[model samples]
Target: MRVRELLNYFKPYGFETPDWMIVEEYGLRPDQIIRMDLNTSPYLPQKWLNSLGSRISKLRFNRYPDTTYRELVGEISRYTNVKPEKIIPTNGADEAIDVIVKALIDCGNEAIISSPTYDYFRVSVELQGGRVVSIPRKKNFADNVEGILSSINDKTRLIFLCSPNNPTGNTTSYDDVLNILDKASDVAVVVDEAYYEYCGETFIELTETYDNLIIVRTLSKAFGLAGARVGYIVASKGTIKMLNKTRPPNSLSLASIELAKIALRDYETVSRNVRKIVKERERVKELLSTLPRIYAYPSKANFILFELLEGDAKTLHKKLMEKGIVIRHIELNWVQRYLRVTISLPEHNDRFLKILEKILKEKT
Candidate 1:
């Protein structure tokens, strides 16, 4: 028997799981591991646990979740000031990306993406037989808006912009984004604010003024509900209607929907934790800066992307792994010299930095 040949696009997509996956796959215990990878919120709110308990006992498990996810959409609408009809909830922001890409781009259409951003955008676009045109960032990891606009053409259907970008903790200027929208009226501009809580900046309001803009957000970072897998997109009603068609019926579980409702009601806990993480993030950056061979970037997100001034980043990562401290190494060609570290609780950040400092000294 012969298997059919897979599409050419699938060939470029490699299957190397991130460093955090290896840490978990190795069966390393938490007490022995100081994980600062994958940008996950280190603290799960106590209120989420209470909400989960109430939901497990009270929710009607036999019935499906509200197909439209009305309640969750309403809560997010009230928080974001967008109408419920303009929002689409999904399993995660990753799902929102796939749904939107599928709805907008056909085979052979182009999807423009800013490089050194999230990989999932390219992966999703490629899986649908869409071509990905990369606009490389500047030396400091800033978006090259001029280059991006120059690359767009009549065939370009979508553009993915990750603000306060992943792997490089800086945001694109709001004005630059607006300029792109002005130039490319035919292409959809997706502003992914997965780390919006940490930055407190957004283009959600722009959706009202521009028909081509869409903003995506997640509850995982600030709301501390990563495991629950809740995320949403805000766009004009027409764009949302098209995206809704691509989403699976009742994609969110009843338990996750109910838990998200409870979490939104108690917003104070999420706000407090986000503030704490931002504070701890600055502290971590300052401490790391003083070390002999470290350079920490200023971040608007809940993580820091830093570089080793005088050693191989992979070597440094290995040393940390041996000591039960895990951090993400930036392996992409554009950022191979850097490493991304998530902001955890105060003590956790302290321990990771302490171990990191010792590793730097040993290398010297």
Candidate 2:
């Protein structure tokens, strides 16, 4: 016999994971490639490389991880300057989103999201039998404060906002976020700051004032631990105390917790790399500005979004792959001509720049 029917609003979504399968089909070796997609950090902090594995091994792997995650919570609290009671370490930021949506929104309730933002928020909200209200961003991919404020209603249980928003690579203003929070204090507002290390601006401080405010963060990007998948949520202790029940037992692995703690301890290493990536971002944007028919948007994240105003983004993306370099080509209707690339090391960044120049010159 078959299982029960699925929820109709549960739409299939595409995640930009590694492309090793495609690389092998094309008869290419892994070492001959540079991946400028997915926005993973190219640098690994030295202390993380040095000690986490051994520290993790000291504990018994046969035992389940600490569901409470006392040590990890302490580290995250120290790192974020939030209290330990306000935190819940998750498997990843994705899990944090899923749990929050499941906890707050009921079937037929609605969650508001600014469009062209992260897809998983929509996926999570819908999967939990909730409707997603889409408010389009401003022309520059900036958050639209008015649109979100007007969209909220009695059924609106959650609002997902991304800073240095994915794909678009720009942040929503703090004042705009404050405005939304000030008016919609009754609804849960999640400001996902996965790229906070690069931008250095966060809503963590505001969580103290607004119990409905939840902040989601990850060790994936700036910490170079995408593979580890460590993430967490911070809010007022009472709010966190309520949502913590929605999370599954042993949500994060032992290694992930230890490693996240290790990474937070070595703030210098990650901070240094973030500084480099920010510099590379500026450099890449300035260089792209000089090229004809291309527009580079200002960003505070680890990646840059550029537009091929005169050609197909997919074609250019495919051409870049032939050179063993990979960048993302976004397919959203609002940004059909845009492509995205992670800021890598200076050498890899140089190669991407030079090859891109060659491709554009040929088009010219």
Top candidate on TM-score is: 2
TM-score, one value per model: 0.94, 0.96
Please give the RMSD to the true structure for each candidate, in Å.
Answer: 2.3, 1.7
User: lDDT tens string, model 1, 1-364?
Assistant: 6643445326554444554665676666656777677687887877678768966977887989879888999888888888999999899898999899989989899999888888889888888878999988888888899999999988899999998799788998989999999999888999999999899989999988888999989998888788899999999988888888898788799888988888888778888889999999999999989998788999999999998878799888877777777788886554466888999988888889888888888883
Each prediction's total of clashing residue pairs, residues at least 3 apart in sequence or on different chains, is 0, 0
User: C-alpha displacement of 209 in model 2, angstroms?
Assistant: 0.8
Candidate 1: 10-residue stretch with minimal lDDT: 4-13
**The CA-based lDDT of model 1 is what?**
0.85
Question: CA lDDT of each candidate?
Answer: 0.85, 0.87
Q: What C-alpha lDDT, on a 0 to 100 scale, does residue 244 get in candidate 1?
A: 84
Looking at candidate 1, what is the lDDT of residue 322? 73
Candidate 2 C-alpha lDDT tens digits along 1-364:
6642554325667865456864775567888689899889998866575697567659778999877999999998888888899999988899999889879989899999998888999888877778999998888787888999999998999989999799888888899889999999899999999999999988889998999899999999998999999999999989998998899998778787788888888888888889989998999889988987898988999999898999777888878888878888886555578889999999999999999989888882
